[model samples]
Target: MSEIRTYADNRQPLDRNWLHKQWRHLRLWRRFLLQAVVRETHYRAHFATTLLVGLVQLGLGIVPILLLFGFTQEVHGWSRAEVITLVGAYQIITGLMAAFVAPNLQRMTEYIAEGELDGVLLRPVSSQLYLTLRWINVAELSNVASGIAVLVIGLVQSGASPNVPQLLQAFVLAVCGLALLSTVWSAMSFLAFWLQSVNPIGFIYLNLVEAGRYPLVFFPVPVRAFLTFAFPVAFATTYPVQALAGDLGWTPVAGGIALSVVAVTLVRMLWRRGLRSYASASS
Candidate 1:
């Protein structure tokens, strides 16, 4: 009877090939995402309240920009509408993080701290994918919707309607920029392996992102360079808007793609090293 139970509990090993393993992880992530959706759907009033709060936060973000423009036509050569477009782009990216990435990071930290990470590590898939894609904050969709609305209004008001190719280019760059930012978030969460608490570090990233709400022109040249190369603040918000507004050039676009690729590679290496350092509760 014990032998029969052991046989029943044992599962087949997964394919060892890289591509096959990745495909399996992809399917696993889809399942995790579906579970998250179902769980979120069960809390309707909570979802609604969260959505309303997100919208209110977005509204509050724009107020300072409006007040700044009231005192000047262009702050550092960025007109009111242009700055609005930047704000919308900022919201869209941050909203995406809040919906998909932030929740996972928070949960991952908990898993690490509580020594529940063994369950995640034992899965026959990429631990990074499982950790990052396990949860989705659907309520944050409100910020996404509001951001698109504001972005369209700003673009129309800016009097620059990008051609189809230009729009496509902007989208590709925006996605690359998002990838870069996700690496930053992943690296921040990796801190849990070493630090006992990382709540304050999470807030610091948000404050850094907040700086992207205005034109990069407002910042000093050194600070602008730091954002562009050392970090990716300009690529995340400014470059995408520049692409859509017909101001983007090829050189910076190439730079953003390169930065994203390098950042992602480094993040993967760091995550693996961190996992090795983790001592699970079961151990």
Candidate 2:
């Protein structure tokens, strides 16, 4: 009777633990998203230049895509319109970075350096969440607008309009692409914990991401295989754009999604493990 009672008590705690974990994930996502709303209210009143500069940068970035169709019918196997749509999807990721992930993560390194991250360790919420949600950038919305314009132009150029089914498929791939790109960015930023300097590392990763602008096909098989399998920018950039261009079928999309999930999950685990090594200057 005592043993059975003990088992029941143990199982009760296990059930509560499961619920706690579920609630934690939900809370984390909610907090992160809500931070954007708070940031927007703060920025619109305090920092109008942030919005203006973001718009200017976004415009410069989109010029190549926006005017590409007029310059040439196509580049390599990708039409000017198709490449623009791909660029649009890529720009959505850029917007997210300029607006949220990059700015926050960069600030996080400061927290780590100054010992502020130690306070986060005492919070009921995860230290990672605290750091990630510490601030928001309001300028990223410009990238979103620019991306949409490029997408519209690309669709018009595709000659045959995408039906609803086709559009839905493209969206699914685009979302996955966004997630994959964010995953790469986060993983690289988190490497600051181990290396103690992120400026050099972050610049390297940014340059690599820039390479995604060109079609993967232009690269030889060895490089293509390396990026697609060894690194994963191909999944984040190449496949989704190709899907929009109608060059990739469902298989490549599925492959990209699967690779993204596996890579991001692994990176999350690694980041947490690295956190154990974090010893802030303050605490």
Q: lDDT per residue, candidate 1, 1-283, as tens digits? A: 3644454566666776778888877787778778877888899897899888888888899999899989999876688898888888988988888888988887766788887788877776677887877788877877888888889889888887999877877887788878888888788888888885667778878888888787778899999988777667788789889899887777777888889999999999998898888887567
- Residue 14 deviation, candidate 2, in Å? 12
- Residue 201's C-alpha lDDT in candidate 1? 79
| lDDT of prediction 2 | 0.68
Stretches of model 2 off by over 4 angstroms after superposition: 1-20, 45-51, 62-72
lDDT of 1 at 129: 82
Q: Write the per-residue lDDT of candidate 2 for residues 121-175, one digit (tens) a residue.
A: 8876656656654555655666677767766776777774666656665777666
Residue 137 in candidate 2, Cα distance off native in Å: 1.9
Winning model by TM-score: 1
